[model samples]
Target: MRIHLSSVFVDDQEKALRFYTDVLGFVKKNEVPIGEHRWLTVVSPEDPDGTELLLEPDVHPAVKPYTTALVEDGIPAAAFAVDDVHAEFERLRGHGVRFTQEPLEIGPITTAVLDDTCGNLIQIVHTA
Candidate 1:
């Protein structure tokens, strides 16, 4: 079996959408209203039919502490693959994205961590 959908807990869905789409270049896939929130999702422009990333709301009681701990410890909530980690890092930094970790090379892979602004740290990685 293969992966289908993964999610990142966000504090504000609209702001998250702008960052994910306008900044990160992912395209909107689905948006359905659900009571006080929406079932929002985005897909990579390169893989429109591939795995979808769900922009989940962190409204649940257990989510805040979990996300907080992850951030406090400098851990990434999710990772997205990019062709060039350095290039992506510079591009994101140009857009004023605050990075917790600059691109670091570890063996065959390179990665950088950036704050999503909506309360999560996301990583971008590339394998050389």
Candidate 2:
């Protein structure tokens, strides 16, 4: 089966949506109300019909600790491939995005980590 969807835990849905769509330039794919929270998802502009990234709520008590540890350890919940890591990093920084790791060369790839402001660290990478 083909990969269709992946999720990144977020503390706030609205804020996460704004960051993903406004800052990162992803397009909103769907938002369906499900009980206490909504099933919100977004897709890259270049792949509007491709895999959707679900902005899952961290309602569970354990989620906060898990998310914090991951971010502090520089483990990204998800990675977005970009054309230029430096340009993308600059663009994101201009939008007030807080980055934990600056752009650095790692073997055959260049990557940077940014705080999604939603209890998660997201990675942006470009192939070298």
Candidate 3:
């Protein structure tokens, strides 16, 4: 079986687009307007045809509290794979991204958590 699409709850689509694309280097894949929000998604530049990350609107009341709790408790909403967690963390930091956890190695894997700016904490990891 193969994974397809995934989503991240975002407060603002436009701002999230800027951060995810301009800052994180993902490429825009699809965008379709629906009411006040759009069905927006992005894919890694390295794998344009791979899984797409949807930037969904967090308009539902429960989503705010749920995402807030996850952030407050240091839980990541989504984890992205990287070649080197430390290098990715440093690159993100240079772009003014706020990190909650510095790169930490545990066993053969390293991980770091950062604020997604919209309303979630995202993790970057590498496994050797």
Candidate 4:
């Protein structure tokens, strides 16, 4: 079996979509209405037809607290690999993205954490 889909909880689907597509550079893959919320997902530009990252709504009662806790604790909802951590960080910073942790060398990898402004911290990493 191959990995096809994964999800990251978001407080707002529309805002999350903008951030992922316009800021983080992902492409919209699907958006299907399911009950009150939509089953929204996005795919990486490098792998447009690859794994889908579902932008799951955090409005569900059980998930709100959990998602909020993770964001408060500075744990990223998801990590995205980048060609250059510093450059990507700068690009995001220029776009008004708020970073919680600046890029730092960690062994063989350099990573930075930033606030998506939609209730989650997202990590950007680069392997040296």
Off by over 4 Å in 2: none
Candidate 3 residue-wise lDDT, 41-100, digit = tens? 999999999999999999999999999999989999999999999889989999999999
Worst 10 residues of 1 by lDDT: 118-127
- TM per candidate: 0.98, 0.96, 0.98, 0.95
TM-score of 3: 0.98
* Candidate 2 pairs with clashing backbones: none
By TM-score, rank the candidates, best first: 1, 3, 2, 4
Ranking by lDDT: 1, 3, 2, 4
Best model per lDDT: 1
The whole-model lDDT of each prediction reads 0.97, 0.93, 0.96, 0.92
Q: Which ten residues in a row have the lowest lDDT in candidate 2?
A: 65-74
- Pairs that collide, model 3: none
As for lDDT, the candidate ahead, 1 or 2, is 1
Q: Which runs of model 1 end up more than 4 angstroms from their true locations?
A: none
Candidate 2 lDDT, 1-128, residue by residue in tens: 98899999999999999989999999999999999899999999899999999999999899999988997788999999999999999999998999999999999899999999988989999997
Query: Candidate 4 at residue 71, lDDT?
Result: 82
> Residue 20 of candidate 4: its Cα lDDT?
91
